[model samples]
Target: YTYNNRINRISIIQEHVMLRRAIERGVSTERLATALAINIAQVEKRLNLLDGICAETADLLKDRQCSADVFAVLRRMKPTRQIECAELMVSANNVTMAYARALMSASTPDRLVNAKRAPKPKGLSDEQLGLMQKEMSGLQDQYRMAEQTYGEDTLNRLLFVQEAKLLSAQALTVIAQVRFAKRQTSVDFGPSAGMR
Candidate 1:
C-alpha cells in the first residue's frame, strides 16, 4: 500500500501549536520526534516558530495559510517590517512563501533584524551600488546637456519600461525626467518607445 504525506501532515501553524502543547506537557525532543514520526530538528523548528515573532504579526498570520519557511523569512525582518509585510499579505490575499521571500528581498537594511548581515544586491556590494547610482545620474545629466545643445526636435522621444530588475523609486524619477524633456512625441517613436 502507498501512503500520502499530505493526509498525514498538519498545517504549519497547527504543528507549531501541537509542539508547544507537547513541550508544556514535559515531552522531550527525542520522545516527541518518535511519537510524531518526524525528525527532532523538525520538532525543534516548530517549537521555535514564534521565537522572534511579534504578537501582532503572529496574530495576523496564525490563521493564514503559510509554510514554515515563511516564518523563517519573517525572522530576518524587524517587528515593524514583519507587521507591515503581514498586513500587505492580508491586503493582497496572498500569504505564500514566495511572497514572503519577495517582501524580505524588498526590505531595506533598516527594516532587517540584523543590518550587519543584510543581503546585498546580487553580485554587487553597497559601495558598488552607490557608485552605480552616481554613474547613472551622470549619464542622465549628459542626456539633458545633449538635448539642450540639439533641441527636442533633433532628439527622438524616449520611454522607459521596467522589465529586467526590481529598482528603487529613483528609476521612475528617471523615466519622468526623460518624458518631461520631450515636447512632441510621435505615434511610433522608434525602437526605444515605451508604452503610453
Candidate 2:
C-alpha cells in the first residue's frame, strides 16, 4: 500500500508536468499519449487524477482556518509563482479590455450609443488622437508585460516540474523497496509469542 501510494504521488506529479507542458505547447492529450508511449485512457486517467488533486489543493489553500502537512508540501512543490503571474495577467487583461472599450467608445461615435459621458468630438483633433494613441500605447505596454510574465511563468513551472520529478522519483523508489521488503518478510511465532 505504501509503495502504491508513493507511485501514485509520483505519477500524479509527472502527469501534471506533462499535461502543463502539453497545454503550454498547444499539444492535445491524444498527442501527448502518443509522445509518452502511453494509451489515451492512461493519459485521461492521470489527467482526471490531476484535476482532483488540483481541486483539493485549491480547497486546502482556501481554507485558512485549517492546517495540513500536504498543503505545506504543495505550496513548496506547486508552481505558485506561476499561478500568481497568471492571475496578474488575467487582471491585466480585464483592465486592457475595459480600457480598450472605453477608448473605442471615445473615438467612435457609432459605438458610443449607450455611453453617458459628454458627447465626444465627431472627428478627433490631433490632440485627441494623440491622447487616444497614448492610451493605446499604455494598453500595449500592459499586453507586453502580460506576455513577458506568461513566458517567465512557463519557464519557472517547467523548472518546478523538473525538480518535482526528481524528488518524486526518489521517494517512490525508496517506498517501493520498503514495500517489497515488507511483503517478502514473514513473521512466524509460536503460540507463546506474546510470552516475552
* lDDT per residue (tens digit) for residues 1-196 in model 1: 1297556545577778888898899889999999989999988988999988998998898777688888888989999989978877886688988888767766666788986776665887777766764674465457557656765544433212343234556788888878866633535566676654
Candidate 2 residue spans exceeding 4 A from truth: 1-140, 187-196
TM-score of 2: 0.28
| Residue 59 in candidate 1, Cα distance off native in Å | 0.6
* Model 2: per-residue Cα lDDT over 1-196, one tens digit each: 2456545333334445668777678889889889989998877655553342345444323312222222222232234432432233344543233333344433333223333452344687858865785786476568768787997899999999999999999999999999978876765556787788
RMSD of each: 19.0, 24.9
What range of 10 consecutive residues in model 2 has the weakest lDDT sum?
A: 63-72
Per-candidate local distance difference test? 0.76, 0.52
Model 1 quality (TM-score): 0.56
Q: TM-score: which candidate is best?
A: 1
Query: How well does model 2 score by local distance difference test?
Result: 0.52
> Would you give me the overall lDDT of model 1?
0.76
